[model samples]
Target: MAGRSIEPFREIGGRLALVRKAYGLTQRQLAERVGRPASYIAKLELAERRLDVIDLEELARALDLDPGLLLSRLMGKDPI
Candidate 1:
């Protein structure tokens, strides 16, 4: 899932971790803002669970990132 798929989970997780770090947030903080379990954020960062579109959008918004940017980065396209 990380190295082979078109949406490589490692890349996605890396990007997500980057965004969270850039925002100076912890997994628990991000989870509270997005109303998700902190373990979910940890799982995402670890590439243990795939995030759905709705969850992605919510996370992007919560992190104050453009949803398009999240979509683009996650899809391996140019950042928005």
Candidate 2:
């Protein structure tokens, strides 16, 4: 089977990093809020890790975002 594309994850990671920064959060801070390790957040932001739905939901909650809205924004679809 072909490997999954990394481009989409890169985009999401970029958006996630931006959002986290906008909230004045460091990787460590976000990781603490999400109950993950700082390295997990770092790897995720670097696109070296992919987020499953549960992970996404936890992150969205930590970021004070709605999971659907966060997903939409990450996908470049703003539901404003």
Candidate 3:
């Protein structure tokens, strides 16, 4: 585990879940706020779908996070 670089999708997925949890928001709640499907959120959390910058920004905003911090964390860099 130590030597492995985190995969982009997995990192993003993890960050998504973490931010959602940090805000005490359920997937359904986040999905509703984002105007996306709950299943879509679930798929994103599972890394089953690709995420984009726009979606990243939207998610970060919804969770009251810095977009850059979310992207950096998702890329496995130390969040600034």
Candidate 4:
């Protein structure tokens, strides 16, 4: 799945971790905000998983960021 990925999981993971930390939310707190399990957030931040569109949208809303920015960065495109 990682090899077939369209988004750069490493960069996404790093950014996601940074944004989450910047908001002062733990993995569990973010997951709770998005109605997901804490493990899901942890896996993404650890680069052990990739988020589907819905997950990305929910995460963006939870982090108060635009989903486009996250998707752009994850896909290696300019965040225009």
Global lDDT scores for all candidate models: 0.79, 0.83, 0.80, 0.81
RMSD of each: 3.1, 2.2, 4.8, 2.8
Question: What are the per-residue Cα lDDT tens digits for candidate 1 across 1-80?
Answer: 44666446666777888889888999999999999899999988887888778888889989887766655654668752
Off by over 4 Å in 2: 73-76
Tens-digit per-residue lDDT, 23-64, candidate 2: 999999999998889999999888899877888888998988
Best by lDDT: 2
* lDDT score for candidate 2 against the true structure: 0.83
- Candidate 3 runs further than 4 Å off: 1-6, 74-76
Best by TM-score: 2
Expressed as tens digits, the lDDT of each residue in 1-80 for candidate 4 is 53675347766777788888888999999999999899999999877887778888899998888887765764668643
Among all windows of 10 consecutive residues in model 2, the one with the lowest summed lDDT is 67-76
Worst 10 residues of 3 by lDDT: 1-10
Residue 72 lDDT in candidate 3 = 82
Q: Which portions of model 1 miss their true places by more than 4 Å? A: 1-7, 74-80
Q: For model 3, what is the C-alpha lDDT against the true structure?
A: 0.80
Q: Candidate 3 — number of clashing residue pairs?
A: 0
Off by over 4 Å in 4: 5-7, 74-80
Q: Is candidate 1 or candidate 4 better by lDDT?
A: 4
